[model samples]
Target: MLPLTLRFSLLALSCMLPLAALAETPLSTERVTELETLLYQDCGSCHGMTLRGGLGPALPESRMNAYSRDGLAALILDGVKGTAMPGWDGLLTEQEARWIADHLQNDNPLDE
Candidate 1:
């Protein structure tokens, strides 16, 4: 069995490896700002200003925990067919979509 420190290090690396692979190019401050606004003003229209619940379902951790980050990103970029959600694939990269997926579940600060 590995020591706790070694195990923790491996676990952290495992978790990060996928994201590191997914997002090769870091989001610039301008792009990040644009996405932030879309997330709030656009997505918020349905997901709720506080991401609680509205025309769309609530996006709290409890709800988001049901899906993996990759799955969530796909859903965001590809959109849910037969639903109100429209695909953003033409407008956003997979990396940006993945960033949004991770952000939504993590309660990222909107002010930055």
Candidate 2:
């Protein structure tokens, strides 16, 4: 019963709905950069500039094997008590915590 023009317009609108929803989601570039800077400044101070062994233990594959991305994010947000690590829940958002964990998970000191 719809006109051809109305049907075509509905089809186009339906096709664009998903993209419009996606566009509403904010990009996390600021959060990602904040995490990167935090790692380079705070963590790097103890873990070494390159994340190799330093005052803190090495963040090598073997050492990092026990941590999942979620686990690592949790650790960052709620630092290990009785240890040198300090919780960053107030300073970083959950997304930033996750970004740091993801970055650490992929870090390879051996890579040139």
Candidate 3:
């Protein structure tokens, strides 16, 4: 039989596994790359290739400060009413929207 300390260690690892999995980003690496592509190629068309603004408003951190994380995610999914921004809910999942919002909010680099 395993030693008491080893058993305890195994139990601890088992308990943490589910939480670690749960905390993981819902999008897989491949999916994230694809979404980034869409975010840059399609979304950038209006928001600007550099996200500095063109047809749409600038998405830099200063301009994005007005939105909360959840609010940004909702906007990404539902879009602004009576505006050029089209809802991506038809194309992307809620998790994907939230991920994109976080990526933007944190000023993380997106593929150009």
Candidate 4:
């Protein structure tokens, strides 16, 4: 049988694992600002700087609200097939992607 101390340590670790999995690194103020810029500038390059539609369709708030937050994050990370949209997974964490998705859905500038 394991020693009492070892058993206690294992129990503590098991309890903490779930909490760790649930915890995402919160975005800093600077990171949020950077993401906003990326959304308008980088994504805007195709979607339009104002998201009024350029090479891509306009990202009206009504349309943005149609997608689930997680679904939108996945789309941002994975990009659409055969489309100009490129996956940003290489440059962003899942948390960051979620933030961008939430921003687009909740705080989008275009109020169509």
Using all chains and alpha carbons, the TM-scores for the candidates as numbered come to: 0.71, 0.66, 0.72, 0.83
- Per-residue alpha-carbon lDDT of model 3 for 38-98, expressed as tens digits? 8878888998877877898768865565689889989999998899999999998888988
Tens digit of per-residue lDDT, candidate 2, span 1-112 = 8999999999999999999975644437876676677787788898877777577766765556479888988998998899887898998777677777777777655232
Error of 4 at 78 (Å): 0.6
Q: Looking at model 3, how many pairs of residues clash?
A: 0
**lDDT score for residue 46 of model 3:** 95
For residues 53-75, write the lDDT of model 1, one tens digit per residue. Answer: 68887777766657898899999
**All models: lDDT?**
0.82, 0.76, 0.83, 0.93
The best-first sequence of candidates by TM-score reads 4, 3, 1, 2
TM-score of 1: 0.71
Steric collisions counted per model? 0, 0, 0, 0
**lDDT measured at residue 49 in model 1 versus the true structure, 0 to 100:** 77
lDDT of 1: 0.82
Better of 1 and 2 by TM-score: 1
Pitting candidate 2 against candidate 4, the one with the higher TM-score is: 4
What's the CA RMSD for each of the models?
8.5, 4.9, 5.2, 2.4
RMSD of 4: 2.4
TM-score of 3: 0.72
Which candidate comes out best when scored by lDDT? 4
Better of 1 and 3 by lDDT: 3
* Candidate 2 Cα misplacement greater than 4 A, ranges: 1-27, 107-112
